[model samples]
Target: MHQFISVTFSLLVITGLRVSVQAGETRPERSISRHYISELTVTNGGRWGSWGHKEMCPTGTYAAGFSLKVDSAPYAQTNDITALNGIRLHCIDNYRRSLNQYHEYSTVRSEVGSWGRWTDIKWCPSGFLRGFALLVEKPQNTGDNKAANNIAFVCSGGAVLIGSGTNWGEYGAWSKTCEGKGICGIKTRIEEPQGSGDDTALNDVTMFCCS
Candidate 1:
């Protein structure tokens, strides 16, 4: 019986079914090479609910991210502008990470009340994007912006981060002409055209410690 049991265990290991080995010396863990912040739904009425969600970002050199799903009709000819129109995405791991990593901010633009959506990839902040503050209204055109406030997790500095990276990375952008057909027709683009609806949007944010 003992010999039969040993043979069965050996077979399991050989076939890669299941097996256990003696504990070896622990090695340091390297950070993961990539990450994507996901599963975004929004309400313009929520409190710092935006800042409330950054707890999920694992530590490392990651691009910043945030998304929203809103009522398409209201967002199209969109109205109201406030910090709370969207959420504020910030970092908890603020020891080594600086507020300088948020870069290359972008998203596909859409305005559908239900199915289709848009991502507006644009320069999020002129200042360092360390922490964000969200309120319950949309950002009105202060003679600068021309569209309604779509629910978004604002990043501070997505451009500078992209320029500093050595490897070619991925990011969302305001596309007048996105490739169309990936992630609910949301993909990389040069212009974030605002239309209507919920799409798989993305924000390429740099990791940073808040001030």
Candidate 2:
């Protein structure tokens, strides 16, 4: 009986199915798989008048998402002509990994309007991306300062894609969902009101990924 039990145990180990003993019965030990963040990087558009400083995530951790604070703070009696505000980077451990590392900046382009380019989106290595969150500026009025207020994201087999929402004058909120087919990266958009003289920007974005 001892030799038979020893042979059975060896076979289980060889086949990657170690047995567990519980309540006088034997069962296979279930395997638990987990994921974690590996690295993070950041950059920005070289605009004038200190829009904010660049930031990075800790080594071996991933960004949870992003947030922003405008210089004028929506409805101010006196708005800033042009000044860099503050920005934040939400960080997470293994449970949440995502992406869309971008920043945009623009100055008053005459009465025609304030315009800026969508900062290039960042992607994860091959099949590591999973989902994302966004932090739009969303000011109260669209006269002197502008910020991205809405955004959208999609995770598919080939690549992750992003788009902007309709409202441009008010910062909405972070995205509700973070599940992606295989979210590997992030994209961003910036818009200005159809008037003259307001520097608007999409300050930053956060991304998540799988281990």
Candidate 3:
């Protein structure tokens, strides 16, 4: 019940730098275009039951934690940015199949309304490995379906890690901003490049689905 494999991509992202993943090869040669991922709910509790839910970055703005591309093999497609190197799988095994293991939204802060703010960022859900906490929906007008609270960047729904600083500190935000409406925005559809270099500098993202 702890066997993970997630690589969903179509490319269309570019933020800070250093996206690495390929230490032991938990499957990250790149290939996935959007389906849903069996329902993504397996990191420990296990529940890839239905197997049909793969939407790996399509709406736009894709970026998670650390994906600076160092050996993902070649970046694959969409907007191609290959140097590929993604694979960390330790957040409790990285794809918990989903059920209950993601509820801690509010770490990188700095809100005043102007699209800019994140201090002392923090997102902990790797209590051994079992990820699923990348929920941050915006566009609140009181009638816009409401969604604006959830962002630590944790996706095992498959692939996405590009780092530089805790939620854009050293540098992140070159492009990818899910403003709001319908999907209501809230996708760590990360995209960095504001400062650059040394800020913990890490990238272990994995996603390849665009054939």
Candidate 4:
């Protein structure tokens, strides 16, 4: 059976702002300026790690592209593999520009594993990212385990963009499409380095959509 941890956070949304109110303090400690209307998730995520802080796109931008932090083949073959380490959301203010011409944009990511190089950004041809699917490896009893291996995104224009991640697992079902403009935020579940135990890096992920 797969083993993992679930993290809970107290979130307060008011007037298009997301505030985090931990268990103790009276006032909010941090606030995200952007507002998300819904969340996207998959069922085949590997079981491991704790959920990281949610990272959001800027107030007026949405995710139109993404990049992956991956441990390439040769490196993975020689070391304890952590195939997919991180996922980054590339955000832009304008969705009307041509796919090949994004002169200005911002990138955001949640907590990431420590053993990979970031791949080049992959853009959606026509519109913003609306949904996603993950390729995840099942738990290998006593064997080397690399939880998440690859990812794919569904654009609003019906085009799909796949990341250059390791080929170790099968792609799970696509997440439910966004209910608003597009995806605007991300939260990742990442496994920390295990001193001598089998290490599985990125385990699961969730996407946020905004209006």
Taken over the whole model, the C-alpha lDDT of each candidate is: 0.24, 0.30, 0.21, 0.77
Candidate 4 versus the native: TM-score? 0.82
Ranking by lDDT: 4, 2, 1, 3
Q: Which stretches of candidate 2 lie over 4 Å from their true place?
A: 1-53, 70-75, 79-84, 95-211
| Candidate 2 TM-score, C-alpha based | 0.29
lDDT of 3 by residue, 47-89 (tens): 1111221223332212223222121212222222221111122
Q: Poorest 10 consecutive residues of model 2 by lDDT? A: 104-113
Write down the TM-score of every candidate: 0.24, 0.29, 0.20, 0.82
TM-score (C-alpha) between model 3 and the true structure: 0.20
Per-residue alpha-carbon lDDT of candidate 4 for residues 1-211, written as tens digits (9 for 90 to 100): 1111010011111101111112111221222556789999999998999999998987777888788899877766466888999998877776433444455666788889988887777777667899998989888877789999998777887766767788787777789999898999999999998888778889999999999
Whole-model alpha-carbon lDDT for candidate 1 = 0.24
Looking at model 1, report the run of 10 residues with the lowest lDDT sum: 181-190
Instruction: Report the number of the highest-lDDT candidate.
Output: 4
| Candidate 4 stretches greater than 4 Å from native | 1-33, 77-79, 95-100
lDDT (C-alpha) at residue 207 in model 3: 28
